[model samples]
Target: MNDYAIEVRGLTKRYGQRTAVEELSFVVPRGSIVGLLGPNGAGKSTTLRAIVGLLRPSSGDSLIDGVPFSALDNPASHVGVHMDGFGFEAGISARRHLEICRLAAGAPRSRVDEVLEEVGLAADARRRVKTFSTGMAQRLGLATALVGSPRTLVLDEPANGLDPDGIRWLRRFLRAFAERGGTVLLSSHQLAELEQVVDEVVVIKQRALFAGRLGDLVTSDADSLEGKYFDLVGGASA
Candidate 1:
């Protein structure tokens, strides 16, 4: 088994003449939650897309448990991913949508109910995706990812539409997941909210800026994560 759950070696992505990500590299250790922080267009999303095989890297590579994402025989079983724009058929019920994804991922049908309940969407299981509030939809998206019971989770702003209680629930859930040997990589613009959950921090300013334990970024009198964030990526722009 590899020491890290995720490893990116010089990963880069380019769009026409613009470079979205430039030789970015990082590692997510097994059983730890790491936050990917960056200003707008700092290449956080680009790097994540490359890692999950949503977009191919122009150069370099990323590996999940020592193997490239594309090489996984059952990818969902190894890594569950949720990007900012996860889409669901508006006409389908949440339960049906998860049922479909569960089948596609080769996960047992029983997992559909388990994940739905786990994400606090069981009561809305029969509701059409279009009828769900933003918070409910976010929960559904997380349910879809959880259906596979993946060892590693890669989520982009998973707390976007959640209420305070929901956010607290998510924090506890992720902490428990990591304690059970699951790995997590989360990216969010909510620095204060992020401070409650992540164990490590990976900050980027159109490039790799800092990567280390969250404690390292918190100096005396600068304990707030938001303060450390601005200090690290000041003047960064899209």
Candidate 2:
């Protein structure tokens, strides 16, 4: 199998006269965590959506582990995605949701319990999703993503609405996940939190600006990723 977990070449997405992502190309190697950094509406979400087959690009294509996302026989097994919302069945218990995903992915039942424990949701496994706090819901979303042991993870703002402790847990979890040879692609406006976790970063302004290691992007002595982001995007700080 190819070493790259994901590959995008000449990616472009346009809606009428407005272009969301333009001529973007990047490769995420196996076992690495890559952060997608940009302001709101900077095409970070759009790029991720296109990569995960949620949206079709006007040009170019994305490959997940050497197979085109569109052509995969079981796309969820290869690439797991978590967007902004949990999208859980509010009436179902968290454990039940995971069990459904496990059956669909053909994963062992043991994996359901394993992922719940991994995301710190084991205690709430039997709780109805409608009763979950935002952070708990986010954990459930993460659990769903991990249920199949997917080779690559595409998450847009996985940290959204998380408390401090929850954020810390997520950072540690993602770091460990990457360390275990899993690939991660995460998009977030929370650069402070991202800098603590991501190994590399892909910064997109109104366009594709930079793609490299995180340490390389923060060389300007900025105290935070948000500051560096503004500098790169040519926007003045408030």
Task: Quantify all predictions' global Cα lDDT against the true fold.
Answer: 0.89, 0.85
Give the TM-score (vs. native) of candidate 2.
Answer: 0.93
Regions of model 1 farther than 4 Å from truth: 235-238
Q: Candidate 2: minimum summed lDDT over ten consecutive residues — where?
A: 229-238
lDDT of 1 at 230: 88
Residue pairs clashing in model 2 are: none
Candidate 1: tens digits of C-alpha lDDT, residues 92-140: 9999999999999999989998998888888889989999988888888
For candidate 2, lDDT tens digit of each residue in 66-108?
8778888777688888897449899999999999999998889
TM-score of each: 0.96, 0.93
In model 1, residue pairs whose N, Cα or C atoms come closer than 3 Å (at least 3 residues apart or on different chains), thus clashing, are: none
